[model samples]
Target: MNPISIVLVRPRDPNNIGACARAMGNFGLSDLRVVDPYEPVWRESVSAVGVNDIMQQAKRCATLDEALQDTAFSMASTAIKNREIKQEIVPLPSLNERLQVAPEGRVALVFGNEKSGLSGEDIERCDVVLNIPTASKQPSINLAQAVILTCYELSRRPGFKAIRHPGQAPEAPTDAQKEIFISSADVLFEKSGFKTDFSSDQRKALLRHMLSRQGLSREQLFFLKKWADKLSSKLP
Candidate 1:
């Protein structure tokens, strides 16, 4: 019953959408947002066994931003391995805890197309990335499968014991702050002559994501700034 919305972006299969709806129903969740869907999500979601009413009430959006306009923050689900990810990877339990006290009133969980998971652009829109562990040989799973796993964890949220994340860690950085931090770091790395053929934005995003997941306190932020300044002095 927490203010969590599941946002599906350009889901290719209507059947998967229906399955996701059913999964949502199982967890007593009804909020659904579909962004740039390839097909009529409501019509396709009619296949949802016991969640027909949810399907009828689902929100369809023309773009991801529109879908998440009311969302306080977003969590992107990624199944690919070893790839550079832009958002911080969080375990299901940690996500559950964070959502319970998330900034703003609501949160959105983003899932990408079945053929391909969320892209860099799609991930950039999210505050964090969640990776569901699976067999190393077969990391990728069906879209519905991923939905069910996440929903299952969500369903058991009330029973989860909350762990007080202490230390001077801040209560997670806002999207804007995260962006600024990463951008600043990128500039410092550039001045340091750190060169990489890899996508620079993605790399910076990953750094931001990691820091955000762990939560950055004022002390940590200041420390990073000092480090950047030190690195800057050594450059040229």
Candidate 2:
């Protein structure tokens, strides 16, 4: 099973939720999380034929943070826009390769509401924004359709195997640890006069992208965090 979590944010319909559960069953992707769902999922499992077990096992979270706090990486799904994107945007085909490089932890693939989609804060909270290719005439896809498509693609990818050899190195940092590193680095950059070259958001985004791509081991991540913490504390 993939270590990815499918997060539905503020879903307002049980039918759609049931369809999503059914889709996960199709791909053998079982980890499902619903944030602020409209109704209890078990109440609507009638539509999710043969997936009652999955629905019953799904985690119901009260907040996005609560849903993703344990995730090592969060990928936000949204429609593509033509404007300059400050965050890293990965294509669906290349996603498999990206996942291979991502550190070991629960990865969350977050979907927005059926109508409005993810909120601004929800999008920002994610590490990457994933956009599926669609015709400009009909850019928006249904929530269940989106889940099925993404899960289908993910199922096609060669899954990640856990490393057991002691020489394999330490595990990757959790999603929360990465956040701490980013925040501490931001403060250090300002004190070191490094923020002058780029805007704050831009720098933080760049730093996040860079560290993520490096695939830092837990010990290596902590080493950077240690210095960032000390340096930030020394600043006026």
Candidate 3:
């Protein structure tokens, strides 16, 4: 099974998406998820060249959550260092080590559109954030180039292996499960009249970060959802 998944969010250029697929194919990686692409003609992109099979098999998703529904661990690719919300930033060179500690499941490397890297809200949805170090002369790398470099790193990394803990640890919750737990918590928050200065979006972002950083297991997620339901019932 392919351990890594490539996710492109809101890509504005069809050529870039095609090129990314080509890059993944070069590294023997085929799982591709395009989330809310801006252009609809990506399927016919000429840059895909001989790697049409990867493009043909790409999955189209309406949202990041859908793209990440089955992924247990996700990394948001961003060039921006400073942000409103804080997330653990992992540099490209150190990615192998980071992956070694990640939960045992399919991993996602999420990339935003060419115009903008990942937004604060998007980064919050991921387990961690990663960036390629480049010279100050040109800070932002091309979207396809970034994917190429990332794939190259993973392909060449010596002794790289996905983490496995067998029966000792429960499976990590999928993004879909995380969303369900978050939605239940949001309902409980609303019904309980939980007042805070942060906007609902910001609050959700923070909540997402909290859940991601902990690497909560599926059992923990179900327990939290149950707790939220019970507490919500008592509130109103």
Candidate 4:
């Protein structure tokens, strides 16, 4: 089974949620997480044919962070053509290759609400941004359609496997570990008077993207964190 979790952020439509669950079932993708969904109707989606088990067992999270905290890498799906952010933008077709590179942990494919896509903060929480190619005339696609397309493409390689380096390497860093390291680095940068054109948040986001691509092992992350901690300790 693919270690992919389908995450819907603040979904507004019960039917869309049902359809997404159905898509997951179609592709043999089991994990489903809904963040801050519209409470009353989402439960109704359990009635979706052939997906009752998935819908019933879906995890409900209060925040995006909670949904992705344990994942090694998170990809936010966005329909917006042009965004100011500098995170890695991946096309949907190439996602399978991308997943192969991510370290051994659950990968979260995050989608946004039906009316509005992911917020900038939500995008920042993810390691990468996924763009589903569509004509410029109609750039955006439906929420359920996006999930279906992603799951379908991923289903092409049913037995998804991650490629990692050889030799007793440390385990992959979880999202929580990455955040802690980023925070430690942020403190170090601030104390050392590091200068950059990007705001602190933007810099952190860029750092996050870089770390995700680097596939830092847990020991490497700890090594970097220790360096940052030691360096920050000397600063006033």
Clashes of each: 0, 0, 0, 0
The CA lDDT at 16 in model 3 is: 97
Cα lDDT of model 1 overall?
Answer: 0.79
- Sort every candidate by TM-score, greatest first: 4, 3, 2, 1
Per-residue alpha-carbon lDDT of candidate 3 for residues 1-236, written as tens digits (9 for 90 to 100): 33999999999999999999988877767889999988888888999977898898899999999999999999998876456647788999998878888999999999989997887889999989888898867778899999999998897666544332246766899988888888888888899898999776787788899998998889988999999999999986
Task: State TM-scores per candidate.
Answer: 0.63, 0.64, 0.65, 0.65
lDDT per residue (tens digit) for residues 42-120 in model 1: 4555569988887888898999989988878789888758677755778766767767766867878899989988888
lDDT of each: 0.79, 0.84, 0.87, 0.89
Clashing pairs in 3: none
* Regions more than 4 Å wrong, model 1: 159-236
Q: Local error of candidate 1 at 52, Å?
A: 1.0
Ranked by lDDT, the better of candidates 1 and 3 is 3
Model 4, residue pairs in steric clash: none
Which runs in model 2 stand beyond 4 Å of their true positions?
40-43, 82-84, 159-236
List where candidate 3 sits over 4 angstroms from the true fold.
159-236
What lDDT is reached at residue 192 by model 4?
A: 92
Model 2 lDDT per residue over 1-236, tens place: 33889999999888888899889888777789999998764436567888887788889999999999999998888886643455799877777878887778888999998998888788889998888888898887899999999988887776533222337566988888888888888888888776366888888888889988999988898999999989878878
